[model samples]
Target: MRLAGAIDIGGSSTKLGIVAEDGSIIRRDSVPTSLHGEPMVVVDAIVASLQPMLDAGGTEGKPVSGIGVSVAGFLNRDHSAMVHNANLPALHDFPLRQSLKERLGFDCRLEVDSNAAVVAEYQYGAGRGSARLLGVTMGTGLGGGVIIDGKLLRFTGECAGDLGHIIVDHKGRLCTCGARGCLEAMVNSASLSERAGGRAVREIITSAREGDQLAMTALAETGWWLGLGLASLSPIFSPDRIVVGGGIAAAGELILEATRASYRTHARPEFREKTQVVGSSFEGWEGIVGAASQFLNPIA
Candidate 1:
């Protein structure tokens, strides 16, 4: 089987895997991202974790063809390095593509994380067969991407414009981007944690699942903001399907049900009738899956 190496670097953790051409992740693992460490810290961790899998490819009759790296930031025009993201400062302007290629000895491609997520959904997961698709990821910050008729929308920052920065509440929270009431400000991990009395996202999800009212409330509030944001964004993209993924989406229906309800409540009548909001099947792994698609079925 044809294979590719995939790495997804987020603000909190880094996931790496070997993915088959059919989009099945053959092997997968994750490591904590050193947000405060130097750039090589991540590069080294990825090499140590993924090299063995890549090596075994040949013996397993699945020799890897290429490597794809997805970073949670804006990439340079060449897609060589992450250039802009307040949360992942360590990788800012770091030559991530070159560093990985030199150590791993494979052709490497870099992609914006949000773009990668949407690409994966379109190719293999929730967005399959949809002519117009929109994907949103929730974590340290919110992100979005768009795909239309099998082609990615690349008009903005290698993905859809910062869909998170759109103001959903002009009087809500202040965002890291120095804006007030940005959708991201209201719906990100930190915001959710604050709303849940300082519980981490994992803790909140677990608690909510076990019937914790406080935790459920936090997730509901976050989902409400997310749904409102999507509604505000729908008119611009008008996607047939919208997929929500990332760390926060692990709340599953706890959040998505609220999101679905709020989206319908606020979305324009035209969008309410047609746009579908659903959770990602990949959970939090969509980024790496899409990254691996660089070799399996390139998006750009």
Candidate 2:
């Protein structure tokens, strides 16, 4: 069976896996994401973490045919390199595809993290059977991507998937991108924590589940903002399905209930009913599945 090595790089961690062309994850692991250091240092760390798995796979006669890397950053219009990112400072202007190829001596495909997430969902998760899917991941940060008729939508500098940067409040919280009231600024984990008076995101979810009124209220407010943002985006994309995932989504009904309520109140009635918002079944495996999926369906 043909195989591929897939790597998904996030702000805090990097998930690596060996996958079959059919999207099965044969093996998977993750390493801490190096944020403060030379670009090559982080690159070397990634190589070190995956070398053992790659070597083992080679000995098993399942040598990987290529490598696919998904990162949270902007890609040039040409999709040749990562342009910039707020969380991954070392990746700016970095030729990630070339660097990986040079180190591994194999073919490599690069993709934006959000784009990879959408592809994984559309092909294997809640987005299945939808002609148009919008994937939103709310975690340490908020990011999104669109898949139209099973095709990934990419644009110059990866601006298309920067839905988190959309301005929602004229005088809202400050964003890492140097903007105020951006979607991310309003609903990221950090923002949620702050809004909940310094409680961690995990704690908030726990408290809400246990019937803590304060935690539940805060989560609902955040979800309301998220729904409002999606309402603003709905007209532009007209997505048939919207899949929400990531850590914050663990709030479950606490968040989704508010989001659905806000959507009903703010969004156009015709469009609101047509677009179904649901949580992802991929859950904890989204990054792994997404990285692996890249090889099965390489960015084209």
Candidate 3:
């Protein structure tokens, strides 16, 4: 079986795996991102850790076809390097593909983290049959990816242009990105915690399920904001499907219910009728699967 090396670089950790041409993960492992050090240091660590897997798989003899990378940042048009990442300052503007190729001697393919998630969903998750798909991730911040006609749509770093940055309240919480009422700022983990009186999101979710008022309020508010953001995008993209993923999404129906209520209030009738919002299938392993798949099938 022809194999490929894939890596998903995140804010806290990195996942590495070998993928078969058919999108199966033959083997996988993970490592800390070590973002405090230079960009090259992290790159070197990744290469070294995965070298044994590649060697054991006899990649050198047949040549592992491509090295696919999924990272949380904007990507250059050529898709060769990470143009910018607000959370990962060390990786900003790093020639990721060049460095990996020089050190590992393999072809490299790079994609934004959300893009990778969308690809995974389209190919193996909730978006399988959807013609037009939108992938929304609610992590520390919101990120989005759109796929139309089984292909990715690249726009000036914003096919949906920082969908999380959508303004829901002109006079609301200030965002880390220097904006007020951004969808992310209004509904992310921090906001949820603050709204629940400094309670952790996990605690909030547990409490809400256990019928706690404070937790329920925080989740409802967060979901409402998320839905408002989705409602705004619905008109523009008219996506047939919207897949929600990330840690916050684990709140399940609590979040979706609130979002649905808000969406019904704002989205156009046609959009409301057409779009189907659901949770992701792979969940945390999304980036891992998508990163591996990139090497096997570069098109998506």
Q: Each prediction's Cα RMSD?
A: 1.1, 2.1, 3.0
- Which of the numbered candidates is closest to the native, going by highest lDDT? 1
Task: Give lDDT tens digits, candidate 3, residues 60-143.
Answer: 475467788888778877877776656677887789888888887788888888888888888888889888999987766777
Per-candidate TM-scores read 0.97, 0.91, 0.86
Q: Clashing residue pairs, candidate 3?
A: 158-161
Q: Which stretches of candidate 3 lie over 4 Å from their true place?
A: 35-37, 59-64, 158-160, 196-216
Q: Which portions of model 2 show Cα errors greater than 4 Å?
A: 159-161
**Candidate 3 TM-score versus the reference:** 0.86
At residue 18, give the lDDT of candidate 1. 93
Q: Please give, for residues 76-183, the per-residue lDDT of candidate 1 as tens digits.
A: 888988888888899988888889999999999999999999999999999999999999999989999999888888767677778889998889998989989999
Worst window of 10 by summed lDDT in candidate 3: 156-165
Per-residue error (Å), model 1, residue 275: 0.5
The candidate 1 region of ten consecutive residues with least summed lDDT is 153-162
**For candidate 2, lDDT tens digit of each residue in 1-300?**
778888888776788878777667788887878886778977898888787888998898888888888787778765567777898888788788888888877688887778777777787778889998898888767888888876777764663668998999989999999989999889988888987889988899998889988888899999999999999889988999988887788777789889888877888987778999888776545665676665676534
Candidate 1 displacement at residue 140 in angstroms: 1.3
Clashes of each: 0, 0, 1
lDDT of 1 at 238: 90
After best superposition, candidate 1 residue 134: deviation in angstroms? Answer: 0.5
Candidate number that wins on lDDT, 1 or 3: 1
lDDT of 2: 0.81
Q: How much is the lDDT of residue 238 in candidate 2?
A: 91
